[model samples]
Target: MRKIAIAVSLSIFIAFLIATAFLIHPFGYPPSEMDDYIIENTQSETGANNAVTAVVFDYRGFDTLGEATILFTAVTGVVMLFRAKKKREK
Candidate 1:
C-alpha cells in the first residue's frame, strides 16, 4: 500500500510537470513587444548605457535582490553544514 501510494504521487507530479512544460514557448523565438520596448527605451528610462544593466537594476531590481538573498542563504547554509561536519570530525 505504501509503495502504491508513492508511485501514484510520483506519476501525478510528473504528469503535472509535463503539462506545464508543453505550454512553455520554444527556445530562442521569444519575439514579444516588451523586447522592442526595452531596447528602445532602456537608455532614456533607466539612464543606463547597457540594456542588461538597465533590465537587472531598474526593471527587475526586486527580483535581483531576491536572487542575491537566495544565493547568500545557500552559501551560508553550505558553510554551516561544512563547519558542523568539521566539528564532528575533530
Candidate 2:
C-alpha cells in the first residue's frame, strides 16, 4: 500500500516536471524588446562600458545581491559541516 502510494506520487511529480520543461521557451530566443531596450540604454543609464556588466551590477543589482547572499550561506554551511565532522573525529 505504501509502495503503491509512493509510486503514484513519484509518477505525478515526474509528469509535472516534464510538462513544465516543455512549457519553457527555446534556448537563445528570449523576448526581444527588453533586450533591445537594455542594449540601447545600458551605457547612458549606468555609465558602464560593457552592457552585460551594466545589466548584472546596475539594472539587476538586487538580484546579484541575493545570489551573492545565497552563495555565502552555502559556503558557510559547508564550512560548518566540515568543522562538525572534524570535531566528531577527535
User: Would you give me the overall lDDT of model 2?
Assistant: 0.93
Positional deviation of residue 8's Cα in model 1 after best superposition, in angstroms: 13
Q: How would you encode candidate 2's per-residue C-alpha lDDT over 41-82 as one tens digit per residue?
A: 987898888999998998899999999999999999999999
Query: Model 1, range 1-90, lDDT digits (tens) per residue?
Result: 999999999999999999888877886777689978999999889888899989888888999999999999999999999999999998
Q: For each candidate, how many residue pairs have backbone atoms clashing (under 3 Å)?
A: 0, 0
The TM-score values for the models, in the order shown, are 0.65, 0.67
Q: CA lDDT, every prediction?
A: 0.92, 0.93
Worst 10 residues of 2 by lDDT: 22-31
Q: Which candidate has the top score in TM-score?
A: 2
